[model samples]
Target: MVHENKHVKNARYVRTVESMFACPVCRASMKVVHYQSLICSNHHTFDFAKRGYINFMNQPVNTKYSKGLFEARRKLMTEEAFFEPLSHAIASAIHAHVAKPKKTSSILDMGCGEGTLLSTICNKVSSRGIRDVIGAGSDISKAGIAMASKNYSDKVWTVADIANPPFKESQFDVILSILSPSNYAECNRLLRTGGIVVKVVPRSGYLKEIREVLFHKATKKYSNEATLERFSKHFQVAEHFRLCYTTRLNPASMKWLVQMTPLTWSLTEEKEMSLAEEISNQITVDLDVMIGISPK
Candidate 1:
């Protein structure tokens, strides 16, 4: 099978996602023009890169989530099914929240890093007979969007700030934020009336093994109580689900697990080798899934 070039591959994503985009400068409605740029009513325009993703920022912003980090995460998740359970949970929540599964729906994944979680959930939801669904993802990191656009060309991938997303108001049916920062005000504005927001945050036990390996103390306590409190200010508090699971790991998968996380990204080759046995044994994934809605 022949692989399409970036231009051809991204053309579809560009079209599917164009309607939701607004002018970053003026916040006006935008449309795809000449298949090369997105033009708004006020005349501010953003161009599509050769790879087909749009750059909506006036200037580049630096972030720690580099190409290497995203690549490592993609490899780890794809190969080991690290976040498979979370993806399934998110997809199920979306399905349940949608009043009409057969009708067209749209989802925006805020701060999507290399698009694994969002891409997986979107594909899985479609497989369940939700055929007319569109997925879009944005991140402030250019490297993150570039990696995501390359792998998942079917979804809208953009290099823009998640705090002020470059999208139209009331355009999305569901918004997903998994272990990523949230701009509650923008999320509230972007969702349609009664739209659902599914946000996953780390619990105290999350990645305890890796934390122990690095800090020698995984006993520290943490809480997301403040996050829920803040979220309630924007949307009615719905339901919160706690998912706690333990994963057994082999040497190779464990290597990716430790390396892919920022906590261990600084581990020297020698240090990693020395601590290999301890970190490679097992890990815990403890997270809280909070579902919210801006009541109509």
Candidate 2:
């Protein structure tokens, strides 16, 4: 049986009601009725199937991310534990940055694949009683968001394009982008004046073990200085942390392991076949986590 997040089950229905309505066409005000579709005053409407998620992509999103890919990602995350350190890093950053007491904290996780990082942070916050979280997880992949919404029923999960998210201006106090593409202009529009954006990008050495096996060469592009420089163009840099951790992946996780990565797309058929045979037993896990804050 699939394990669902119980915190989602315990949340008040009112929270779910308020969280579901975001206009798909205009990204403006919407009213959700019958737990199905959200309709805006402009007459634009979006439907949420019985599984519990709404698709808000204005134009067709052309990509390889599918239901199988997201399921593989979720399975790999749960089995290989790729996000354990990442989650702690995010929670710690939030605790360190939010100095003042807040009545509620709003977090918008863009390109949130299967809701692993966001769900982990929410569980941490609830367990510690740091603050009530209005956690919203969005992705361009409708299948991904649908899976996330079903598993994390309480979160405001939507099939939203990161380049143009469906929400009002300056709504989120914290935005997260983990190992995914980001639209800085849209992110800036969605965040409050002094909100924070925590990003996790792979360093050169990240998953060196996997790269070493999967391909002949892999780039260690997008240096920290470069990232900070790019982000500084929009928001001030608050703090930087270099996070690295090593863990071993079990044999059962190897298939999902390959499916869970960008490497899946990067590797050639011959190289992928070779990599699959090389370490069918176990493999190493490596990654980096970075955080930036909005201007005060």
lDDT tens per residue, model 2, 199-266: 77777776676776655565455566777678768776677767776666665566566666777786
Off by over 4 Å in 1: 1-5, 269-277
Indicate which candidate wins on TM-score: 1
RMSD of each candidate relative to the true structure: 2.1, 4.1
Check candidate 2 and list the clashing pairs.
Answer: none
**lDDT (Cα, 0-100) at 18 in candidate 2:** 59
TM-scores of all candidate predictions against the true structure = 0.93, 0.85
| lDDT of residue 103 for candidate 1 | 63
The sequence of per-residue lDDT tens digits that candidate 1 reaches over residues 190-236 is 99987899989999899888777678775599788998888888888
Q: Which candidate is the best by lDDT?
A: 1
